[model samples]
Target chain A: MSLIPSHERPDGDPLRPIQRFCEVVTYCATLGIYAYGVDGPKVCLALPYCEDILGDADRQWINTGAITTLIDSACGSAILHALPQYEAIATLDLRVDYLRPAPAGGEMRCWAWCHRITSNVAFAQSEVYVEGIDEPVATSSASFMRLKPQKREAG
Target chain B: MIEPGHLKAEAALPPPEQFCRRIPHLQHLGMRYLPACVENHSAPVFILGFQDRLVGNTHLPALHGGAVASFMENSALLHLLMEQNGTSRLPKLIDFNIDYLRSAGPRDSFACCEVAKLGSRVVLVHIRCWQRHFDRPAALARAHYLWEPVSGNTELAEDIRP
Candidate 1:
């Protein structure tokens, strides 16, 4: 399991549904993409390369899908940082540009910034970087729609 | 997942079934290629089965956007590979853009990809994903893949030459 705790827990909210949603979201957790600290208008995350994500048995490279998942989640997380109370949001569109396929076996990180927040929509952009690498491995931008609050799932 | 490193050094081109099996993530996610429609159109069809692991919103019970997006991108790569089997090397993704038209219901999903443009060094593909109806798309995506053409020439290359 990921060690990073929910940023909303200490606030007694314990459930930033947005963050929790992404955590359980299939691609992110499977590949070890974790939520990092949040700055003023930006949210960050870490992506770790694991054996399971390797594209093939012989190649020491990860799949494009894994890279896309990291970008998509990073962009979506910034939407949570943009909201006043961290409400739920759904992705409306996501665009990712991969500069190159990073070699497998190193940890990569992403930082997402929300530049615009309207009454109903939020926009975010993010970049993926590998440690010890000069250029970014990939970049992405996405839009999310704020969702109405919902009651917690019944225990 | 087809090991990116092992793709070089050519041998007999594995059939589509074996090709998809090589990519662990695609198989784990239940992605499959059907050849029924390839005769009509140059592209093949891909289908992903619905399961608990793919759910995003447990309440609305919709398929996860990441899952759908990954599926589409993988299909784009698969279709491009199928069109010409000259190279065993996997294509590098240049970029992918996806638009969610509607919530994808939790069901088996079907999709197809068309090669919009194919250059010696770059290939562009458009994909449409749907569940219940062909006209109603749950999501659509455009993807670009970068790789040296099989023949290694832009126009001189015979479609796919090794």
Candidate 2:
């Protein structure tokens, strides 16, 4: 059975707000990453391959850096989705394991989920899959520091 | 695939700058090689000039975590390539772990790497990235790379000399 909520499925526009958030992040925007939608507790993102993002031109392989960007963005978005209310967050640490080379000319998709959220930190994990490939190309684990809400003062 | 005729020892190897330049993503990110004085450090240094497209948080106006990671990874690759005297194929990245020490502001970011262990099949590199003071680093990374052995290459047997 599908774990995603019916309303939050990709067919609906539930991800419009998250998509807008991704648009403002210049690095994410530059990479042409898009928020696909929310699946259950996970957030989905996609990166379409382009010639400029190639690391090994001879092999037509995508750069590891580009793959890192995709995972980071997806993990951050997952944290946002898991939170009850909007809160500022920053990456504390990230670890990526490259299982195999992701060849260029295919869209790389990622699904990230925030499994734990404490008062100070949030932990997320992501798996990156390439089009036509069944196994994950890469996997990542990341932690985000949740900034304390700033107290407003009367003018 | 490497051609047999293209294999040579030291003189025929392409410069690190040329190897770095051939990467489209590095060029896209505007990363450049900076020659390092032999006395200060052994490995070459790299600089990534701050650009609007590299920013992750416009509110804090900080460099993206991934951008910083990319710079450090590139730095490590350059270091390994220099140590091996260049290889026909690029080293495959096995894994990378990074810690964000501080937020990198809008400025040119610099990176340098230290090889922790040099093995016949794999090598480990530790990378540091900073915007201002070298002591105050913005990020630290450890990456492991699988070295693909090329036939008739004697340099791979010596391990990293430096």
Candidate 3:
């Protein structure tokens, strides 16, 4: 019983709204967060580092914040794989360890897995890498609090 | 009342008013400075309000998690820059750990930072984000920055040497 048809391959593009939300609200569209799909047990999303929008003051290196944002989006999207309903889930905590600064303007990709889920909490972990690069730039773990449905406001 | 060293440390620092102007990303997010008050005096309080483009979940009309995280990171970075006073190039990010206490509402959000430790080579800062009530924090973060002192700073070399 999938809450979100989009997450299940049988339902046809359940992650569409998530992708759109990433593009618009999160400013992740600038990071190129479009490519994604369910791969075996994990969900994968990939995008190149956008130097024009994601770079730092000198524009010489990728800002750590950009990498964090990418990891958050990927992790959230991965959580949606398990609970893909339209209702929003809030992130409770996020921890990212930067092993090394990512190469400036390199192609970055991420794979996320929903490791555990309970009645009200969900835990996810992910790893980010620069495309074709042997070393991963960062690793992240995040917890999401599933919120109860709220009363809708009238238009 | 402020401590003499605190005041002197602060005097060595840049005014909070100029922070938004100095960092491009903060400018991009439209973060603004708020004056000190009784509750928060450790550092200048900065704010990022609700905006259409900042919304990640249209259904819930909520802010993106990454944007909130980035805002918090910048908040800590701003505090670091103030303490460093051009002692180093932009501090390199070593790590970022964030805890979201609540679902940030669609309203103005404020951030305050506290420097846990300011060593010669590294600095650690704690930041909290709140809206409407400072008692209720929407998110909290601890960030570590690698401070690479710029060359020719005889002052810094001497301080670290002995």
Candidate 4:
């Protein structure tokens, strides 16, 4: 069974299906991540704070893993937005620098952009910001291995 | 629940299983603490059981990169905490760098951490993760944490103490 829904493509835009596909991802959905939209070449996503996602219960800080997940999802979506057509990609490496702790009880916004796309790899960077904070709480760089399309079986 | 003065009162650190159970995120991911006997190493090991919600790529049927990273990071943190006896405050994560050596298949993943360096105010940890075999690792990570000394009569400490 196909994971993506079969329907009319809206505005002949290639990104709509990709966006929809990202929204339904089991991991992303479980984390409460939602794609805000695409701005220029950047894709924006949001992760709302929840008790289940907290790393430090006493301090009320979001888990670094959750933040990493948000950034990874945003970076992956940015690659999809950059590509002319949808192609599978896997993360080869990801480095996250936590400038400051992300306080809980507020939504965190992430912006990612595919800085470069080589023949076999795609590089992306992302920054995460909490609402009302001017400085970014965390920043990340990631490289994804672009996979070749699979061959279809003859009818 | 762990008391605020628990670390200070005891000479030895709490067990990994007891400490990890308090972390809501680890609980959410369904991570279980495994004894050191599971691996040949002396360090404690952690297992992340496979579940549909943890899958990032439905096509490849692989675990999410973030989930794997999370497991490694948590392992490192727990290792540091377990080894660092009498540390009142939790270490702050300064940075985490991970290399995905292979795609983590949709199965139970394992992780173990080693302390590369232990300094006065900084600690560095190396983490390795594998699914099927320890020799063939799925990913490796290096994490830096800021270790703060416990200060007496500080409002921050008073506030954080439960």
Candidate 5:
């Protein structure tokens, strides 16, 4: 039924695979907040657009969903950008700290960077902030794992 | 095995079920505790009801990461109560970490869990919150609650402490 032999595996990991993974996770993450009408990775961390979701002064301190969205998007982007170097990339772990709640009715912006890539894992960090403040509303760090396709030997 | 800090009726502490009622939404979400209890000091910790409104990307607008964390932490109180039959215990949050894979749509989130370990002085719980009907979770958090034993009178005094 199969085309190739089980022992002869496929060559490398898929291209832009992280993007596909993000798309799936993005869809699943918003299941709880469907009433808000926010969807997709495109809606995440887009500066001015973030304000639309985080409206109001009193509501700002309690809105953390925006931060969650931003972190997911940033991490996705980081992994996708590194897709070419698949073997060198992986998410080891991620941690997020919410210092204070974001302002209500304003979307939060996130920017994450892959700070270090090790033999088997990658370390990444990101920050979510409101429109005005330099101080981040939330900060997160993530670890990713990398795997390489084995090269076939000449028989 | 019960921890030394486990609340016994002699401790005269509020029941975890009562505390679960304190949050009407938690009840609406159908969160239940295997064994619920209350702490003489520290934030109340318990477990989630049976169903969480938000799961997958269905309820995108309403759920907040902070709210999810609060739900997980608050539920730990119930777990404590059930463990001790409403006895006084010291509550301590060791650590909680959440991975935001995507934004949850606006829906009630559900969560369930058990105490991974309860030691002579420390209780570790692995708690998870998910929206109803969704395979993936809105968030996952694990909290370690520390219970310290004290005289019944001392427990009451601690509860009254500002």
Candidate 6:
């Protein structure tokens, strides 16, 4: 993965919550872990390379485990980024399908759309791609729980 | 202290050879297979409580994500190995999902899984990786398997005993 995104940010800018989230995701992705990201409209996240996520005994490409984590993290990050906006969506369920094996040594870009935001729940779908491509590597759909953030009683 | 139900035994372990047959990939990883409780129904589930090999970095390096995924996949595949108690066979994975709660510390872990549904064409499996200290879990997974049943093998209802 490239550090281009990090370098683009001007120095001494106090990090935003969303930016922090991106760093967490990037940290994991760079080390071959799965974590959340900054891009929305299609919420972005990264799935890093690791020997354990490979299926072929040969360890040539990513496997089902990596794909599974990417979809889950993408959906999770999307909900988190939009949490202040949609107060009621709980994650009811999520499903993902891998079109083919994603190559190792690169990060996955997950772009998700909030298809529907309802009174008590939100629905969304996402596509995962590598190195900015039109054909998706994987796709997913998710449902989130909706509830008002907890309030503290007056002392 | 470990919970009474969680502690593992030494005997009755399912050999890793069972996985090598089909995936042939796991064998190359050189992971040791420790036995789960015998009551788990000849399940292929095994545990590799924390070992130094799993640590990735110093100063509280979270358990490697790749390691976490490996444990999850191994737990799911154990169901196929369990099917052959006395023989050897490899089962094909149909589908699987995982919900990660937190990053694992550099400690031992317990891996367990089972076949929830078995049919002529497909089987469903649920797998989990529980940390030694944590109360909730490091991660949880569910997987589906496509079975190529051995001829002359009898079909039976899946036991939820484990």
My TM-score estimates for the predictions, one after another, are: 0.80, 0.86, 0.77, 0.83, 0.44, 0.59
Give one digit per residue, the lDDT tens place, for model 6 in B77-109: 654565545242344555556565665776666
Q: Pick the candidate with the highest DockQ.
A: 2
CA lDDT, candidate 5, residue A109: 62
Minimal lDDT window, size 10, model 2 chain B: B1-10
In angstroms, how far off is B141's CA in candidate 5? Answer: 5.6
Per-residue CA lDDT of model 2 for A54-130, tens digit only, reads 88776778899889989988999899888877788999999999999999899998889999987788999999999
In order, what fnat does every candidate score? 0.58, 0.74, 0.56, 0.75, 0.08, 0.10
Predicted candidate 5 versus true structure: per-residue lDDT over A118-149, tens digit per residue? 55565667777776677887777776655453
Error of 4 at A121 (Å): 1.0
Better of 1 and 2 by lDDT: 2
lDDT of 3 by residue, A49-111 (tens): 554334355435566766788788888777777764654577889999888767666677777
Model 3, span B12-45: residue lDDT tens: 2223544433444565666665434423465667
Candidate 5's C-alpha runs over 4 A off are A1-22, A26-60, A63-73, A85-91, A132-134, A147-155, B1-162
* TM-score of candidate 1 against the unseen true structure: 0.80
The chain A TM-scores for the candidates, taken one by one, are 0.75, 0.87, 0.75, 0.84, 0.55, 0.67
lDDT of each: 0.71, 0.80, 0.69, 0.77, 0.46, 0.55
Off by over 4 Å in 3: A1-26, A29-32, A84-87, A149-155, B1-23, B35-42, B152-162
* Regions more than 4 Å wrong, model 2: A1-13, A149-155, B1-17, B38-40, B151-162
Best by lDDT: 2
Output the better candidate (1/3) by TM-score. Answer: 1
The C-alpha RMSD of each candidate to the native structure, in angstroms, is 8.3, 8.0, 7.4, 8.9, 13.5, 7.5
Indicate which candidate wins on TM-score: 2
lDDT of 6 by residue, A52-127 (tens): 5555443455555556555655565576666554242334555666565566656677766677655566677888
